[model samples]
Target: MNIVVDAFWDDEAKVWVASARDGIGIATEAGTMEQLQQKLSIIVPDLLAEDYQGPFEIELIARSHQTVAAA
Candidate 1:
C-alpha cells in the first residue's frame, strides 16, 4: 500500500520529525531529514502490520498571510 509522509524540522529539538497523517498517524523523529525518512521507512510498515482497522482521513490546513491575520 502507498502512504504519504510529511517531514519537517523541529526547531526546539533541532531534529527532523515525520508523520503519516493517514492510517495510524505514525510519527518519528531523527537528527536529519535523511535519517527521518529512513526511520519512517521502518516505522510505516510496522504500523501497517498492527491490528489497526484504520482507513482514516486527516485534514491539513495551511493558512495564507491574510487568513492568518484574520484568525
Candidate 2:
C-alpha cells in the first residue's frame, strides 16, 4: 500500500504542515520540511494501523506558496 500526503508552508504559523491527500484524514505540522517528512514516516504507519494491517508505502506531495513584493 502507498500513502500520499500534501505539505504546505504556513507563513503565519511559521511551520511546515501536511495532510493526507488520499483521504487518510491526517494532518501534522513541523518547524521544517525535513522534520515534517520524518514525522510523516512515523505518523502515517501509526494512523494506518488503526484500521489497516500489513506493509505500506508512503509518498508525500508538498506544496508551498510564497509572496514577493514588487521591487
Candidate 3:
C-alpha cells in the first residue's frame, strides 16, 4: 500500500511534525527530520493494519517558512 504523509516544521515548538493525511490516524513530532523519519518508519506500518508485514511506500510532504530581510 501507498501512504502520503504531510510534515512541517513547527516554529513555536522547533520540531518537525508528521501525520498521515490519508486518514491513517497517525500524528507524530520529532526534534529533527531524521528523528521524524525514524518515528514514521515504525508508526506507519503499525497503524496501516494488524499483522501488516509487507513492502510499503510512504510519500512525505514538507512545508515550512522563514523570515529574512530583503535588501
Candidate 4:
C-alpha cells in the first residue's frame, strides 16, 4: 500500500503538521520535518489492518511559505 502524506509548516502554531487524504486516518504535528517523518513510520502500521502484510511505502508531500525581505 502506498500512502500519501501532506505536510506544512504552521507559522502560528510553530510546528510542522502532517495530514493525509480521507481514509488514510493520519493527522499529526511535530516541531521539525525529521520528527514528523519519524512519527509517520510508527503511526502508519498501527492504522493498517492486522492482516496487512509487511512492506508499504509512504509519499510525503510538503509545502511551505515564507517572506524574505531584500534577498
Q: What lDDT tens digits, residue by residue, belong to model 1 across residues 1-71?
A: 55666666666787766666555678777887667666766666667766644553333221212224555
Q: Roughly what TM-score does model 1 have, to 2 decimal places?
A: 0.61
Candidate 3: where is the Cα deviation over 4 Å?
Answer: 51-53
TM-score of candidate 4 on Cα atoms, chains taken together: 0.86
Cα shift from native, residue 22, model 2 (Å): 2.7
Candidate 2 lDDT over residue span 1-71, tens digit each:
88878888888989988888767788999998889888988888888896888587777787887778999
The candidate that wins on TM-score is: 3
| Best candidate according to lDDT | 4
Q: Rank the candidates by lDDT, best first.
A: 4, 3, 2, 1
Summarize candidate 3's per-residue lDDT along 1-71 as a digit string, tens digits: 77788999999999998888768798999999889888888888887668466577888888998999999
Task: Indicate the worst ten consecutive residues by lDDT in candidate 4.
Answer: 47-56
lDDT of 4 by residue, 43-71 (tens): 88888858477576888999999999995
Clashing residue pairs, backbone N/CA/C < 3 A, model 2: none
Off by over 4 Å in 2: none
- What's the best-to-worst order under TM-score? 3, 4, 2, 1
TM-score for every candidate vs. truth? Answer: 0.61, 0.81, 0.88, 0.86
Evaluated at residue 57, the lDDT of candidate 3 is 82
Better of 1 and 3 by TM-score: 3
